[model samples]
Target: MKNYWYRFKHYPFYQHKWFRISLASLLLSVFFFLITISNVYTETYSIERFTEAKETIRSPLSIENEKETERERRAAIQSVEDRYEISTEITQERVGYVNELFEAIDKIDEEENDSGQSGDDGNTVSDKEKAQDLQQMISPEISDALQREDLIQLITASPNHRSLGKELLTTSLYDVMNDGVTTENMQTGIDNIKEKLQYSSLDASLKEVLYLISEFAVVENSFYDAEKTVEAQKHASSNVEPVMIRAGEIIVTEGQTITNEIYEELKLVGLLSDDRNVYPLVGLILLILLIGAMISYEMNNYAAKRELDAGKIASIILISVLMVAVMKVTSLFTGSVNQLFFIVPAATGAMLLKILLDERLALVLSMMYAILASLIFNSEIPGSLNMEAGIFILFSQLAGIAFLVNLKDRMAILKAGIGITLVHILTVLLFLFLSFEKYSMADVFTYMGFGAVAAFLSTVLTIGLLPFFETGLGILSDTKLLTLSNPNHPLLRKILIEAPGTYHHSVMVANLSESACEAIGANGLLARVAAYYHDLGKTEKAHYFIENQMGITNPHDMLQPEQSAGIIINHPYAGGKLLKKHKLPKEIIHITEQHHGTSLLKYFYFKAKEQNKYVKEADYRYPGPLPKTQEGAIVCICDSVEAAVRSLKEPTKEKIAEIVSSIINDKLMDGQLNDSPLTFKELEKIRQAVCEALNGIFHSRIQYPTNQEVKEAN
Candidate 1:
């Protein structure tokens, strides 16, 4: 039963990540299709003319009837009377002409008096002569209107009367023409002049003459302002907003005949028949394909070559699908409150991926989740995408990613969550400010609250789900490494109790390997954990290893070189078995087994060769699969370098650097590090890091004088 269970757990078919990814994609697509299918299933109507509705229908969206609105605006603009300006200059000029005529008449009378013409006699200038003379002085048209008697009265009138007449005529013309006066209001202006003159002491005939002069002075001053009128009409039209049919508002009731207006509204809301429109489905498929391609490309490029196995792929797919599911489920409650979409825990996936995988892959997956969110949470516009939600998710995920970079502890997830919340708040405010809609404080706060909740929930869910994915998927997250690095771990505790010297040595090696691996961009935590367990098998025979022998005589001295080499060779394999028994991760087991590599045990090999001329080099060599990964290779170099440097009588920085370089060069010559992915540049960096660490560990210390020596010197 145990064997069957183990086999079932490791079954390839059940663990095939490609198939899991495909299934996850299909499920996501189905969910998206279910949510958005309503946009495609529009109802068809056949009514062409207006008809009475069987039931009342509301607009599906707010839209403007541009033609009707424009018509109303134009009518309003046209209702405003044409504006005009009064020309005071014309009034002044006409008054001056009348004065000149009077002056000319006075001049003619003076000349007739000087010539000794008697008044009221035939010899005096006749009224006909005066009239003929006035004709030449004024315009011929005005001269024709004046009668001989009128001319005679004007010539005989006093200067005060002429001045009074001129004042009344000019004042009435100025009053009437100063306002907007068109040809349509000319007679009205004339009547107003007559009324004003009637109250005067002037004769009725004189008032009538003043009225005629006022009428002639009146000219059209107001003109049509077509540009200003058109501009006003446009302003009014623009102020008329497009009527919107909000989401969930009814368009046409069932069994109701659709009118042209109703049909257009339905079409605007994407409710009209669109049986031939496969564009949405096609677009959805294309988007899915694009996401899949990105995932494939990113995984191929970012993950370690051997680490690009089914398990990691499964983990990636699981994280993505879980995030998408959270978004979809949250969308179900979105209703009219689209901001509820912010409560979907968008940062959780990026945080999980960053913890379980590489940060680059996490960033890529964050983008994918953001894009999917935009598509899924667009409930307000059925067929349209919600770009604001997409941007919000993008920044939220990025915040988590940024916070998780170089993270050292599991509790940092909470800090990252807080960061994500802040980012979400900022993102929500930015989008709100960008929108044309007016949002109340309550609405803004509500949306911001949702964003905060989303960020907090991401932290909560990531913390809650972390252990499960790490344990279930056998993923060696940094948190898991930290846990294993703890001194309280059973294996670590066992090593400490059974072989204290070995435990101390392992700790020193761990420090060296961690720094070295980190310098080369490798998994430093994994290297540290592996270093702690690398010598666990030494507990079974603590006295055989020199470090744990403490002051005891060397047991290897009594044993043959072959026997000592065999014992040394078996320790790595034995440690690997013990790790398996403890159910530790395979990566740790592999690192422990490969740290010794296949390098020849020079001490044993040379000693045996001196004793027996036929001693074989292979007999003194360790059985190894070499260092297959950079972390494992780093452990191998640190393990040897730590032991070598600890044996120095009085170590200096130079001595430590020499020994570290020697050990690394020997490993390279022996082909032990050939299988590792470390480049030449990375190896140089690792060498420098190892030297720096060893220098710190074995730096020269000041020696204080003994009490007796100090007293003697004094």
Candidate 2:
């Protein structure tokens, strides 16, 4: 029975029955809530007191003539026919042109074939027969020149081959030098043609003929059928004309009656979809799925990675579910309230999510929340669903949450809340402008005011609910940490008085860590608070550390090195105990326990080594499991960097930068930074922030003389 119970309890699927039930319940609730809200908003929007519908909302094209339908039908058919006729004409013209060029090609091919067959025994031919053959022969260049329809058309009326003649001469001159196209071949072809037709007959009038022959030779050597086809296609396509079809009104004269066939065609084309409805259902579904996935993934990752208590998980999930329910309720009031009233539902959910969860998940879930809110208020499928409105709200609310990332104080969150409000309003305003739809300025202003109110309420809800989750859920938000760990807070003040030196050192480390976190967009306030409470164990043995000792002789100098190492190494656990005794948050206790990690007190270990020569390195290290929370991890870095910088007799910015970088690198190499959210780019930013803070802390101050010294100088 014990073995079965253990296996069942440890199984992941069975361990969190409450979570599974809650998630399923939440999904069902959202579906029903949306349905209920949709009905309510529809009813309220229809009420005259909420929104006064104009008595007549005439179609924009009502002024057009009634016979417009018949006239448009005839015009469209005629336009298509004309286009077809024009396209056919261009195609026929191309085919005819290509046929003429092919005829010239056949004439040249027939002459070449006849000459090849007439050759006798490979040797004997009469000069007269040769001359007749040469005279009858079409120059290969001329044949090719005629085949190029573009060039042929250019000289079809009166052939001019001056350009071709010049180009051929230039090409042949280079070829002759390279011994490629020999002068002898050129001379033989020329002489044969000249003997048949006298040299004097080859006048400038015949210059076109000479160049044409040369062009044929060049083209026949290089021309492919594909090239001619492409040329023909270009010719055919260039002559085709665009056909235009008029849009808008299809009515004719006012007295004319509409035909059933025309009306049915228009209806089919959606110029008149008076019946079927197409809701923006896909967008709404996508929004829901995306939001649900983000929330689920974030919640799971947080629970698993942080090893949060079951109670904390329940609290976080409870708050998330409650926020969704609140949003549904608020959406119901959208009609009585301004259009901007819907933003309250969106911003409130976003702020709560951001506070309870991390920014990436919050932003993603907020978009889903926005989509759900849209579906609630605008459920009508065909003409009523405001898809643009939903999208605008989603994007603006997402931007708002993104802008609030890593904020250090409540005021900052409040300020960001206002900014988020403005973004939501502006999004709506832009939508209105682009829509070009008629809406009233009074309504717009009313919605803007509603948006402001919504933003304020969102901030209020977030602030009020934060502490419940922080304490009951054992969750620590940036705002909660910043508020509780303030310098003037009662508990912090007590720590300062009880251990003044440790308190001062903590404050300095907080400054270092907070700025570092901010530079890198990590949780700055969390880091700062963690840094403050990291040394709470020192309160128990304040006199032992050098900072609390002042100029007094070191207590460790008298004590054995092993005893001293134990005292120093044990402070982290002691601090954790002290924090727990005071009922401080678990995260704070973790900060105390993990700040030192398992790092060794090397000085004490070496001191023991020299004295007894029998000490193990393990005896000098702190009893640690290292930092688990982002805050704890950040505190560890800040603590080491601050102490190392301060210990330097005269630390400059350059030296501090190097030392800070080296310490962080060592921690990274030791795998201390693995679980933290900080990426490499963020670490570099933290390094810069640390360097800046260190420079300020270690700034050189002028020494003032004592009375005795002043008297001696005088």
Candidate 3:
């Protein structure tokens, strides 16, 4: 619970109300679409059933019940008459049942006829034999008619009469209303029955027997009609409630209403719902999931490829949110945004990735940007999916990212922007043929125009926004560092003028540091550039340092041990502050601050200790947060090694190696090398590089000596 609360407070998305709002809105939209789709299908089917019910209620049998309700006093007399009429109704019921049997036989014949199985084959049965087989299924009711083939022939001869006979079976109940058997007829029938009748009424059991016969006849007729209707519409495939279509069947087109065939396909794929509007929402959600996965993959790749600062990472997330908002707002006005909305994020992220991180990460970020663009373009309420424009923008970004893969200069980024325009035009025309199937040159041109505008906008925005992040956020992008590291820059030229020895030393150190860094898998360019600025503080009092003093009198000769120690320790800290003021990379600032990690000012420490018993060894130490990065540690080791090796009057490969190794070992033993990732193996490699560098720096030379050296040699 505590961890959850901490995340809620600290995590950016959890803390941001807008993220929550967007998430909730997505879920609500899906739910609303589900309800709408379900209701559409449900209401349509409900209306269908209601119409059927009204038709059923309009039958003639329904009117008979109304008439029967109107005569209550005559009901008793009518009941006696009704029995005689009901007795006659039983005979009609028998006839209706027999008619149903013939209707079933006729339907089977019709089916066989359509299928080309109506006794066309030599071995197949004739229509006479098929009638015999069907008569067995509808026995007793159809038996009497079957005994006379002449009666079947008569029924078959009148084709309309056969159909009319089937309709009469179901409509026999209508005779109750249409014929209207009168009370006069009923009374005359009952009086004639009295002559033979001793009992006042017929047996109750017998009346129930007659009613059962009538009920069976009605049910048999309904079944026969339902079966015939199903058989007639067999080609319509209406028998089964859920229909199935075979593969390769065309279900619907762009202008067609979703047909039963299409609906069945959707059902087969489990895409159709009790509600219908969910398809668009489903498409949107799928895009969201895809975009999210791509973003995560890119983020992971960035973390793997380069070391990202927390502040820079936050800036990236901020840009993503801003781009998402732009997509939403622009799509509302027109379909202009489309997948190109992702280009804004991609272009900005690519510039940052290339400058602040690496070029490979920029390509990954561009693809991720395309995914986000698709989601933004396809969003039901806010998406702007211009199919043609979206395809153009996607390839445009791909071309842009591909063109600028290893770009280091502003001109390269600009050239890539123009290249994106051409790529966009070609891709739009290609996708027109591939995706849309029809190509219109004018439409393609219009899409290309939009794409070019989008790419140009991205370039302009990238250029404008890059500096703000570089300066305000303290990020040292490649472009920013390149600009600052120019040799003609005022600070570098000033260093060259006032402290030529230190300037020369910095240049040599830059080469040594860069090579060593690359050897150990560290940032080589950063290490090299940092080496140049690490000793800028020596410019404040150039003559005080021995290298810059040269033939001039050294001021250190007059200074006390404590004063000289203070001067030595203060330079690195001063350099760090100066670089910070100029807004250099923190990595560079760290190299300056940590280059001289609390090592003794040996000359001053020994002198002070001999002269004054109270002069502590601690006071002679340089202020330090020891090297915290591999590059910083490399600079630290390189700094000491350079000065120690240069101090040798005559150098050898063995002496150079020993001196470099001793300096590195001393720092390691003193715990100054604890933070950086360099291991014993890397340190050995560095020792070798230093030895190789020293051999080249002080190569073997013949003694072409001064006058004293020449006289001694002769």
Give the number of the best model, judged by lDDT: 1
lDDT for position 378 in model 2: 50
Q: Which residue pairs clash within candidate 3?
A: 37-275, 37-276, 37-277, 38-274, 38-275
RMSD of 3: 18.3
- Residue 386 miss distance in model 1 (angstroms): 7.4
Candidate 1: segments with Cα more than 4 A from true spot: 1-139, 147-166, 170-202, 207-262, 265-271, 274-301, 304-308, 324-347, 359-411, 414-456, 493-505, 536-574, 600-624, 642-659, 688-714
**Tens-digit lDDT track of model 2 for 1-714:** 563466567877636644653574366446644543332221111111223332312121122233544465445444441110113333233233333433443454455557769874565444344333433444443334443333333232222233343334434422322222222354544344334333333345444454444333321111134555555555554444332222223322333334564343333323343522233334444445555566566666655444446555565456556655665565555542345334554565566666766666567656655555555555322224446556755865675576666556557667777787787678667766776567789867766766677677767776777778777777777667767786787657766887788888898988888888778665677677877888878877888988888878989989988888888888888888877877777877877888877877889888878877877888888767877766677789889887888788889878999999999998998777765666788778778878887888777788899999999999
Per-candidate RMSD, Å: 7.7, 21.7, 18.3
What are the Cα lDDT values of the candidates?
0.77, 0.60, 0.60
Q: In angstroms, what RMSD does candidate 2 have relative to the true structure?
A: 21.7
Q: Assess the local accuracy of residue 98 in candidate 2 as a C-alpha lDDT between 0 and 100.
A: 34
Candidate 2 lDDT for residue 219: 17
- Tens-place lDDT digits, model 3, residues 1-714: 564466678887644433443443344334323322221122211111112221111110001222223333234333332211234554465556656665666766666666575456546446576666666656575455344353345334445544543344334434332333344443333233232222324333322322332333422111124444444444333322332333223334334455453454444333333433445445555655555555555555655444455555555555555444555565444433243432332354455556565566556655655554554444332223435434443565567667765444657777777776676556655665686345467666666676677678767767787787777777777677677679997778878999999998888888788778777777777788888988998888888888798888878889998998888888998888888787677878888999887777878889998899788888999868888778888888888888888899888888888898899999998888886668899998877776777788888999776998888889
Per-residue CA lDDT of candidate 1, range 1-714, in tens? 564466567876655444455555565556545544543333444334466555545443344555556566666666655445556676566556666666777777677777764445556667678767876877654566566667767766666776688788777767776765677887787788778888998766666666655656666765567776666666665666554555556777766777776766655554445523455557666777787677766776754444655566668777877887777777767764466777778888898888888888899889988888887776634356778778888898899999876557667998787788888889889988998899999999988998888888889999998888888988888888888888999999999999999999999999999999889778888999999999998888888998988788999999988888888888999999999999898899999999999989899899999999998888878888898889999999999999999898988888888998899999998999987888889989999999888878777788999999999999
Estimate the lDDT of model 3.
0.60
The TM-score measured for candidate 1 stands at 0.69
TM-score comparison, 2 vs 3, better candidate? 3
Rank by TM-score, descending? 1, 3, 2
Clashes of 2: 20
